[model samples]
Target chain A: MSQVPPEADLATQDLPSDERAMLERLRAGDAAAFEQLVRDHGGRMLSVTRRFLGSEEDAQDAVQEAFLSAFKALDRFEGQSRLGTWLHRIAVNAALMKLRTRKSRPAEHSGDELLPKFLDDGHQATPASEWRDGGLAALEKAETKELVRRSIDALPESYRIVLLLRDIEERDTDETAKLLGMTSNAVKTRLHRARQALRALLDPHLRGGL
Target chain B: MLSCRELVEFLMDYCDGELPPEQREYFEKHLACCPPCVAYMKTYQQAICLGKSACKDEEQKPPKMPEELVRAIMAARQAK
Candidate 1:
């Protein structure tokens, strides 16, 4: 397993009772408590934002924007969900907005021109022969990673957004569906298809004989 | 016997623990007697493992929060 940093692991831990109490106080109009909440959840929010936006600069801006938005909407927070969940909702929206803005600008090369050509066959398995030659293993892995990223990026915007929010970010299905304004079944179907598409992209790189 | 496509779809939901108990019982019963589905399940599991390994290095790292940005946020909050 890849080693996650202790601080990052700590960020995922349940909030201490003291912190939760502070958050409740913040909900009751304590400015200091609000600041503490920012200090606690800011890193994790930025981490998630970076995953969505694919750039550090954009992630920072998104985190800042998300924090501001969260502060403004504090009154509306129902206190049913965890504070982290609420902040994450804000961060995802901020990141998606950034993506939309970037999309509006014409790209130097259209995505159609850069997409890989692959045959569609329900029965075809990835060739085991390609995984041989240990010397090329590293290069193959890099290519596979790029292929998976491209495959994900190729999904329809709605599908891609839901996949990122639900799978990569580890949001519960109900919360994800609510955030995307989708039914839970719709979210599940899209997620299943998204994983299938990703698997198809990766099939050619598997070493084990299929 | 479930076709390859149906098996794969069921396995997708199964692996995620999303299948309802009744549906899960049906799939498990089918898996008990079907050689091809069992083989297919192993391949699918391996494929997911390989996929994760292949992309593990590419996992995105969180960006460092700039001191200035943090300070700015703090300042903005104070002003508000």
Candidate 2:
């Protein structure tokens, strides 16, 4: 048997009864239940969509589309998962669809430039410098956060999307793979390269922040 | 006996604790002597911290969900 990843437990951890009731109410066509669903889940859904689409208008539209789709398929909801998780999946799907339909997607390119370089003999060509004492400690500063956000936004779309799904969302590799329609190995590879690129982007600023 | 380049490849797995026992020992041994690698690892961890912190934006008042969005969703359901 394949050993389950620890994060798999997170998926099934909190199958709360309240979400079950919410799902029931939603399926029964209770307007209040519908309103509650929107009011309760809308903010987080918008946040998820925003990370993917990066535009307020696009994110709002994606969340609206997700809620509509979820409402239409209420009868198909099996009460097995929390209503929020199901809706979260729908929202991510909607966001990806929005991304797909955009008229001007960012052009594709290899991220090899951002990855570390090694000499033919396997030594680093240019060794990474140690950040000045506790230089990285300033990462939580609002200015640093803003820089981090921009660095992430600067990545190529495919790598950025995987990084957001896996790292920012803290999603399991399997869920990310399923959402992005790639093998788990592919997701891991993209995530690794994304992290490497992001580190390279942030290094100088973090060192300067020291 | 992992080279610096080889050890860099093991980083994600090393942080994930997915490396086998022998390989993990070798990775650590390499780390003990390599300041650059140790710094590389710290920055790597910092990268993950920054990435996860991006999600904290959701916990705040997150630019109010569009006022028309719920109404639109309700209308869509009614039409369906």
lDDT of each: 0.60, 0.78
| Model 2 chain A poorest 10 in a row by lDDT | A1-10
Model 1, span A1-210: residue lDDT tens: 101101222231266577567667876878677667776777777766765766678878888878877777765555555677667767877887777566443332322322222225423232222333321244355555555556555555555566677666667889778766679888887776655554444445444422
TM-score (2 decimals) of chain A in model 1:
0.55
- Write one digit per residue (lDDT tens) for candidate 2, span A1-210: 111111222332255778767766776779999988898889888878887888878888888888887777776666456676677778877888888787785565677898999999787888877665544467656777678878887887888899988887678999889877799999988888899998888888776563
Give the TM-score comparing model 2 with the true structure, all chains together.
0.80
Please provide, for model 2 over B1-80, each residue's C-alpha lDDT reduced to its tens digit, 9 standing for 90 to 100. 78889988879999999999999999999999988888888888887776677556434545566668878777777787
Candidate 1 docking band? incorrect
Question: Candidate 2: where is the Cα deviation over 4 Å?
Answer: A1-25, A76-82, A100-104, A132-136
DockQ of each: 0.21, 0.60
TM-score of each: 0.56, 0.80
Chain A accuracy as TM-score for every candidate: 0.55, 0.75
Candidate 2, DockQ to 2 decimals? 0.60
